[model samples]
Target: MPVIDITSDPEALTMTVVAEFDAPVERLWSVYTDPRQLERFWGPPGWPATFALFQLSVGGRALYAMNGPRGEVARGAWEFLAIEEPNRFEVLDTFVNEDGSAIDGMPTMRMTFGFEEAGAGSRMRCVSHFTSAEALEQVIAMGSIEGTRLAMGQLDRVLHDLREYSQGQGTQTEVLSDTQVRITRLVDGPRDLVWRAHTEPELMKKWLLGPDGWTMTECEMPDAAPGPYRYAWAPVDGGEGEPFGFDGEVTLMDAPRRMVSTEHMTGTEYPPTLNDLQLYEEDGATLITMIIMYPDAATRDMVLATGMTDGMEASYARLERELLAV
Candidate 1:
């Protein structure tokens, strides 16, 4: 999807997505409207969704169900707003009842899809508009920032796959892809310094999650291998400020060389991310390569969009400060 000029007030409930497609208007429209086509390339990067049934007519309703990393299903529905083939279309998407009925007291979103000829291919935009800013605020309130980004990120793979398939036939033309977020860092410190910066609760509090109200409550570094280590951080937001937490199983633990941990966010029941941290000597400084693999494409994307690597950058910044202190 291409980026569009949006006039949403973040303080309210806002849902907007802009994407560009390299295919022609007809192909893009077909993929958007057809349930099978959608199922084929449905979802963003890490989170993939399956559309159960679809009918592209006024007052016609459709069902969509998305499966998450831990056997959880997220289902929703949409009613056709306007259906114009190969050009424009709109729909009202809603979270519904068990019998496939719309749920009361829930905000139904209006989504619009537009495909225009952009040079050799097309510029496609999908926008989901909400009724109020409160809806948007509620999502943030519920700590849904990461989940939302993951969902959108999953779309990247869908578009990429769609583009590659069409271009191979010499039929599809201008699919646009966004730049991926990459991380690069130079830690000018000793191996022990870096390890302590990561493992020790005292030092970790400075560079890791923090300790004022947010404290590293528990940490277990690998004793022999990676089997039994867990690092837990909790925010004392309400009572003691323990607002958030991430727990993981140590998959690999080789000091100053590589470390791997499978992490699940505190609020979530299932582990959704695998954290791989590699440390090596480059020139005179220590080089670290960190990779986070999600359970599915959708979850990975959500974390990316929520500035996951940005947190890495911040951690590095703090590491630099701690090094200077020593």
Candidate 2:
């Protein structure tokens, strides 16, 4: 984690967060100023931000919305107060409505961010000033501290070259919390092809098989949200483990970009997991980010213990080789 410390002062009516990064101040500043890069980690794990408007100059404003996993949205805006280039800046941040109007009772804050060189790396100090101690406490009670930590934790990946950061790494999994797990893999294919591989039954059957000597026995894809989809697999020789499958309904879909669905074992009563998958394409390759929300810590651990990451890597490798290589 990059966050070093977070402190709140009731007397000063403020909250301060300090974080250190392995990148330089200039590099850190670029990500914050660029809307595309900022959106990558502006919100927490499951709730990703999308910047609708960004004006990066003093007296300018920015509008963004954080989209939740269950089709919820929270809108916010920032008015730039000061700009000091690669070093510091200040903004007035406030909660807003879909129409860009300020929320009547929501608290607003003034925030300052300072960046400085720390040896070969850099350090960032952020201080947010509130109108009253109650305002600071309100935000704290809303999981702002943990949310900030998790959001900034995603910066390391944004700072590195996408290929250098994920290529040859196979499928990597990170436990965001007890019930939330993030899995990422870089596929050597365009985002459209990767999306097709996941949605088109013919393309999926070619690489969706988890391991060697297995074949997809069934694949029923949904046409859109609220539509049910199912997949089943079996041993090639019918001599190994018994056939198993998963069924779910596609709750949300943003073709070639994002999809959210509920997943459960075909014939089991276990609680379904929420699967949020997002794809980003750069340099002719796609980075797949999947965040799975489990029912509980025990279920998360049990699923991970089943060599899920290894199986995913096997499938992705096959995707690159069989489907995308041509």
Candidate 3:
């Protein structure tokens, strides 16, 4: 019953979200593909949910029931029509009679889940096809829109805080010539996951650097905006660490694709770091390329001398491990 943003018209339903989580696609995919795991996080903010019937193959059914705060319950089911493992899933899901029968005069619908890599995390989009605009209206009215948002939000939180060891943190940026460092190693995991390691704070803290006492003090992504946006990672006062910190002002926020920013949106205390991150689908996985354009030869050379390629390889190693398990 919270504010539900209208994403599509009521008839031909379509909802698009490009959120970057702190985990790789494999981990994200497992949470949706594995029913036993999926049920654990299907409810909205305060509801506890459980899966009732599940058959995870093509043509199977994935059904779930949710218990509200007052103990009232609602049930839903998606008839799986296509299952492409971690890549795509199509299902005809909808509400039914309290007795579990298809409602006689209600909206019938089909929602498809598509997966692709976006910068530093997996981007999952739900394309819901309705029989009519009226049907689309009916489904969103039943909370499908907000429910999906909440469900995926939980996935992001889980991945960022996963028990996996924090691997690498803080790297000096630079421009690279394929040969100088002999350091370019093609990471086997998806590039999108690597993007998360760089930007998403919860994961970034584990692998990227900031002031010794740095913690993300503020972060925001406007639904639509230009020019200044903010990302603040600064040393925690009273914490035992150096007073290193950097603030970023938005150059771009394409979401799950790429983001460009200059240093310090709030003030100019810290030097600017020109950062560019890209994510794309490639042979069997995602390929991520990051370019840091510096002002002169000195800073670029200083960053290169830090041996970032090896640092990148080490952090990517953690990503590979998590994906294979999921």
Using lDDT as the measure, the top candidate is 2
Worst 10 residues of 2 by lDDT: 234-243
Q: Tell me how candidate 2 scores on lDDT.
A: 0.94
Error of 1 at 279 (Å): 32
- Residues 230-283, candidate 1: write the lDDT tens digits: 566666555464355666667656676656676777667654565556554533
Better of 1 and 2 by lDDT: 2
Ranking by lDDT: 2, 1, 3
Tell me how candidate 1 scores on lDDT: 0.58
**Candidate 3 per-residue lDDT over residues 53-96, each given as its tens digit:** 78887778767777553335777787889988787888887777
Q: What's the TM-score of each model vs. the native?
A: 0.46, 0.98, 0.46
Which one wins by TM-score: 2 or 3? 2
Look at candidate 1 and tell me the lDDT of residue 84.
81
Span of 10 residues, lowest total lDDT, candidate 3: 177-186
